[model samples]
Target: MTHSLEEHGTEREGPLSLQEIDEIIGTENPPLRNLRITYAYHQLAVALARLLDDRNATWCGFGTWASRTAGLFIRGELKPRPVGLPPVPPWVSRHLMTWAAPHVGSNVARGNLLVFQELGPLFHTMVTAYTEEDDAERALERVLQPLRPGLVTEGGQDLLIAAARSYHRAMPLPHSAARSQVILLANLQVALHEQIRLQEAIAASLAPPLRAPFTPAPLNVLATRFWGRLATSHLMDVYMPAVDFTTTRTLIPLRLGRDVGGAHGATTFCEHLTDLIDLELKALLYDFDRSPNSVLGSAAADWSLLAERMNYLTDFFRLWQQDPCLMQAPFTPRQAEDLRAGKMPSGPPL
Candidate 1:
């Protein structure tokens, strides 16, 4: 089925106003709604590009960080680290990335890169505007000139939806339903775990002065959470409906099977992630009584929290880099040899 921006509450006349965009985002359903949010962010990024000096080293560093960070979610590269690392839990196998489609991954990575390159600055501007007692609407409109061409055309939207569906169809089929669920869950968990690690790394790489600009105010924090929810929802609610059935059937039994109890049993990684996303949404979009935190006080908190994890993992990977081992199993002999010789693998493993 074809989807249009109009179906998700955007008007065709000229450009979308902030109110209209908010209403659409507030009321629309998943996948399409998620796509709309992405479209909005892309617009914001464009606006940010117009406002920021591209030649500034700090800005360039931020772009590089954003591109690399986006890669964690889109590229699906398996780390060289052995399984059972902090993010790579015991349940995750080293060969998980083998199941991913490199072409699809590359397309997704490119799409993500387009939006992420300016996202940090976009958020910074929004929050800064709020703090400065500026005309928030005017400031936002200046950055988001919706009259211009959007990042995703209708054809591009169709392609994205189609790509997501293709990724779902290509999911591996194992001998039993249980095995299939395990593989699916493992892939999801590993992707998210690795993403968190990458976030930590990106946050750490920025010097305090450089990172200060990216520090978000309460409004931007809410915006960040909203963007995150929409992104994840695009995968779970829109792209991977099959996940719902699998999660329903497997979650309880899987926990019981492992005899998992206490706080951990209360929620799985996906569940906890979803809950946090929802909580942030509720606080930002719905909660009227929520007290706003000080911008500077909490400015560094988010980055610090993200940076805390993956330190050991970071150190381990750095150590492994000194004497890299030959790629094995999934890699062909030639590919393995090239890797050992410090060359990029020449072609697809297949």
Candidate 2:
């Protein structure tokens, strides 16, 4: 029997809070009706990340929670797949296909290449210290000394900024469908760069000598898991959906909700997206389970928090389908001006 949300769990309480809604649509002309749902999934991602860090869980525990959370997410129910839809344009199909296909392989390979090209000597230094019976702490410090800030600088933060400039170039809105492709791609580029910053921060937080057993092995393991999680969760849950939403929205106008063909076409466009995302999640979980960090033990009580977060994210997806504007809210005038001027608003102090 197909499970309904009410039957299995509580009714959908969406991700965004009332205050956030106010921020999205200011007081002057409040949305005729408040959104029943909020952007809960993004919140969940942030919360889960905080838990991982604040708890300072072991590498194994971190790996396990990530894998399981992704697993439950993969197995969760999505909106019913649409049937009898007309075909999308070849360009749209091809673009969606690229988004669905696995990209982690090339990305991970590039990461390894960077390690060898830039960090090879650093690793060599550590190995030599081990062989020479030198102090592991001192060796690790020497290796990490030059790498932290260098990782942030050479690693594409600047490239991301340069790429955002392309987004500011005015494009014809009449061709919004096609233009959206460029816009979404540029945004994903920036998001990926942000992911790089996250990965770097994770690496930097490790005090080589202080953490002790100063070896590259555990660090390498952590790096692999970190990249895997980012690629799977971010690409699957956020990027692909954003692309699908844009493509479908551009091709099939939201006002055509009552038009059978238009609705079906939109549904078809999003139909396989979740499945594609789940495929990647499964692959990620499998890789994590096979890694040395996967331990044989009971899951922490915090696992429930992960489950709850996944539900929030899932519900957010449903809420977003009902109203895409929630996730793709229009940029305010000041925000647009800032973007055009190539000035990023500063994030809150860390």
lDDT (Cα atoms) of all candidates against the true structure: 0.28, 0.28
> What TM-score number comes out for model 2?
0.25
Summarize candidate 2's per-residue lDDT along 1-350 as a digit string, tens digits.
Answer: 12222331112223323343334233121111111011222222223222212111111111222222222222231111122222434454334323423233233223222322332233233334433445644544553444433234565344243223323221222323233333333333333343354454323222121223565887866544443332222222221222233224222222111211212333222321222322323332333222111122212111112332222222222222222222221122343233233343232210
Best by TM-score: 2
lDDT of 2 at 94: 38
Cα lDDT of model 2 overall?
0.28
Give the per-residue lDDT digits (tens) of candidate 1, residues 150-268.
12322123222222222223233333323222222222222223334345333322212112366568755654443222222121111111112212311111111111121122212
**For candidate 1, what is the TM-score?**
0.23
Q: Where's the lowest-lDDT run of ten residues in candidate 2?
A: 29-38
How close to the true structure is residue 3 of candidate 1, measured as C-alpha lDDT?
23
Per-candidate TM-scores read 0.23, 0.25
